[model samples]
Target: MAAVLSVYLDLALGLVVTFLLLSLLVSGINEAVVRLLSIRSKFLWAYLRDTMDGAGPHGSWLPTRVVDVFRTMPFLRDPRPAHEARPAPASAGEVPETGTGASMINLLYERVREIDHGKQGRTSIAEIPPARFAVAVMELAAANGDVEGLLARLKQMGSPLYGHLKGVWESAQGDLDRFRKGVESWFDGEMERLSMLYKRYAKWVLAVLGVAVTLLFSMDGLEYAKTLLRDDAFRASVTAVAGSGQGAYDELKARCTGAGDPVTCVTETLSEPALVKLMGQALVSVSLPADGEPEVRWNGGAWWDRVSTPSHWPGFVLTSVALLFGAPFWWDVLRRIAGLRSRR
Candidate 1:
């Protein structure tokens, strides 16, 4: 019984190392992606812009549009802002500078006014239905008197949303009916584009993180497996514990996917020195001379010597490729390997 337990303990310890390596790689990749692209900040900025500029019956959080209040006319207030009284120079030619700045709030304000009042600033533009947008794109289109000019202005605005709209307009080919369809179709494509962008960048980030983590921990999965298999003493120890049958395997599986955190649960049970010992063995087992000790520190000398050894390259490549398969894959493998005790 003790021999069987010892054998399983070794396997459990090995699993702990794998789990920590996976956790480190995944988390490190996430951090790098977020830092490199500021994904959260950009997401928040877009959310706030949409909320503040809301035009639906349920949205628009600000009070009274432009606060047009009089002794008797508070409810009859104009939707224009107080700044509307001055607007900006050549108000005809002056559209809001609402891109990539606090001006989006100001842009949303102007848009609300246009929606409430009219598009053309007169009955003609007003008669056109209120198009849904925070920026006065329709007003700009009306003011420019041509869809082409408005599309140009949208591109120059530097807002990704508006740039998307411009793309919609261009694809419509000057037919108003086609333009409406273009807008809808373009939106769906852009949504897909956003998803693909994340996946593409995430893989790049993950690869970088995997390399860094592999080096830091000196993990070489193929080499470790080879050494463990060849070591009759080590193999016999684990096989005995594994012979305890289904119940023991189930227990190991539970610990691998432990309640709080599989990685953390395993880590807390293993010592730092124990892990270092395992990693160091994996890193240099091939070159390790019969007279030499396996307790070598990871350094340039160790790496150079290991790589220069005749048989270490395949093991090194295999280890890197195993890591590329990611944590979930190995976790499943670990569970299956543990469950094998019952079948035997």
Candidate 2:
């Protein structure tokens, strides 16, 4: 029985490994496909531009829509005369910069006004037009000859416009910083999520395989049952009924094993009423022993006896570890999958 169980267990382990590997492969393929399909050259360019602008003394967070638009337009990234970087005209301050920075400052003021009636359109450091502000900085830069001194003066001037431009520039810098942080966070989160997902998948496959192993291992119990059926005492009882040489056989034939219950080895032997009565009398004379005393059969001998075996300890430890650690991970994955499907 133990040998048979071991064979089944080994097969189950193999199946579990196969399933786990398959799940990992599937997940990897899915990740790769998503990466491949999401090749956003335009988005990359926009990101780079935003990065550059932020790095410049005057850029802010680009709008999500701008990112989306760039993603949709493949040629947007390609260099063109219009797209080429041109130095801001020293006098372009009169014309408003029309993009993320301007839009964000406007949006911020609008939101602030909505929340505070008394503070309606309060001049924030974010609203100074970049070009106008850049000209101011250039003038400061030319006057001071030292970029650091110019920056320091701008920081010291403390006018609402100066403050707003500085705030906007700082805010842009902050946003770019945040984007870098977000990228790192996202990569870490994604890698962690994938690892957890794989571990969970592995566990679930192992569980199903474990159940199958248990079922296969229980097959030995069926064989034991068969052995019980073929016991000498059971056969003798059946033989004695057959020996009752009379019409008993015909009558009791219909009463042999009612409903084919293997536990009760009796079978219908006759159909005739008189013969059935005779067969019944003969069965009564054949007395079988009561059920044998219950026994606990250990596969690897007593627990202590098998503890010293190298295979026994490792197998036991691994199985225990798998069950203890793997269950929660598996449950989490199932929950996540359920959540994802629900969203869909």
Candidate 3:
């Protein structure tokens, strides 16, 4: 019974470690693709337009005078081109800024821009907090004295923005604070839906990256498990490496603290160099089939025979599916399995 349990532990630990390494590689590649394409920014921009101007086909959403306010906001009014680097912030109490920077919308755009591109500034802001966005919209709606007057104007103009503000006003029961909170809640709900769509898109990216990484690395999930179970020396080496890396994993986890977005946290935490180093450590335990000669000779056997008898499709699929679970899931499993083994 003890011997069987030992074999099981070895197999589990080795497989978990392997999956964790593969997850890091796939995740990093996916993040790179996302960054290159500016996927998050695109999604956020689309959401902003749709929410402000009602759902419609892709194009500029500035039809109404109020909606055009987005283009005239403090940040948007800069004469400098979009590609130019933003000027450094004013030093101490000295204010040499040419633009009147008293807009909350400017602060929100700057904050979101910083989050998306680090210190770099871009014309397009990726993320807008629901609370800030709601406040900005309310301010725009009430630009001329009161919301009722704006709603009267909005009705004449047949603007979609009127319906959104009217609903919030009715729900607020005449309380100004309640109206603001209601607007925040409404925007927050929309953002939640956007988050779901973003996650769905991310899953597709993960699936593609997972398969590519599996094929490139020759990671066959079934074959790896079989090898670990059958080869005691290799299994021990993998288990040892996996166990010794606990401190590194813990440190990485610590660094992920206060990362508001989970996906961003993962991508930034397992950076390119870190992923390469970890994968290198994991690969040192066992050689992949790609590192070896073909088991079936192309000249000796028929092409169909070679393809059918020694095909890696099943193994590739298995590994790819395993990687979709991501690194954090496998890391937790590794920790639990290690604890179980230690207790025995």
Candidate 4:
């Protein structure tokens, strides 16, 4: 009974390792792609456009500077001519006269300008409290436009990002405190969305790698299971090795976990293949072919012959899904079974 249990357990562990190895390879590849593609910068740029300054270069203004009081400071603007130092800058409203929304830096700049009360230009989104943003919106409502009308105008002006926040403002019903809280919550939600997107990317990477690894190894989980059940000698041999803990298992574990980069793992470990070659090399007692049977090379059968076989598809699928459980899962199960064997 113990040997039989170990047979099933050993097969499960092997499949799990295959999946885990593939998953690691995918992660390593993802890191490489991220490094080479610099995709995060694109996402950052998109996020900035979608949520931040929607009135910059690709925004409402052209690449050249605007001459209005809202003109951006080009790192080195004339020293106010010394003879003609004008009121710093002003927006087109009864609001404070420091800076306006015309040629702002980013969404942060626009947000800060709307909220500045002292005309001091000291407050900014980076440091100013969330309360100030609320104050600015209230000021806009009081002097320039009503909140609802302003939002409607923004939507019309391609500021669709703000449109999503319409409900928060509406529910606030002109209550500054509640509206401020809602704005904070909305920002939090966007951050959470970004996190989820990264996680989703990782999952996709793992899935693609899993498929590749399973095919490369030609490991059919269902077929492996079937083999263990039907062949008593092979099954007993595998159970003995698994229960005692194979040295190759440790080597695989160490190589996989120790390799800093997954590319190296592929070159060093997977280069020789797993199930097809490693089985014979690592286990003396686990050869599938009878001593007299011919040992065929390179997966033995031709492409269509193996793929078209009805028995092949299900096992391949089972192996793929088993990988989704990940390496940690199989490792844990294998350890628990080993412990049971030690006690018995």
- Candidate no. 3 TM-score: 0.60
Give the range where candidate 1 is weakest over 10 consecutive residues by summed lDDT: 65-74
Candidate 3 wrongly placed segments (more than 4 Å): 55-124, 153-159, 233-310, 340-344
Clashes within 3 Å, all models in order:
5, 19, 0, 1
Instruction: State the number of backbone clashes in model 3.
Output: 0
lDDT against the true structure, per candidate, is 0.47, 0.35, 0.57, 0.49
Higher-lDDT candidate of 1 and 2 = 1
Candidate 4 segments exceeding 4 Å error: 39-156, 173-177, 193-205, 222-312, 326-344
Model 4: lDDT equals 0.49
Q: Tell me the tens digit of each residue's lDDT in model 1 across 1-344.
A: 89667655665557445654665566666777564443433332233234333332343322222221111112222232233433333233433444443234354344444424322231111111223441244444566666676555545654345555666677776776666666546544544554564455455556656665555545555566544443434334334446865433443444356356755544543323344444554343323433666444446577556656657657555555556666756766666655633333
Better of 3 and 4 by lDDT: 3
lDDT per residue for candidate 4 within 1-344, as digits (tens), equals 89667666766665555556655555576567654443443333344344533644444321123331123221222111011112323442432223245311233344454433321222211233445545545555445466665565555555545565587888888876787688767766665675565555556555666766656555566665554444444334344546875743544444468678855663544334335443332212133443576654453354335455678788768767776666666656666755634334
Whose TM-score is higher: candidate 1's or candidate 4's?
A: 4
lDDT of candidate 3 over 37-69, digit per residue (tens): 545665665555444334444344322233222
lDDT measured at residue 34 in model 3 versus the true structure, 0 to 100: 60
lDDT of 3: 0.57
Top-TM-score structure, candidate number: 3
TM-score for each model: 0.42, 0.20, 0.60, 0.46
The total of clashing pairs for model 4 equals: 1
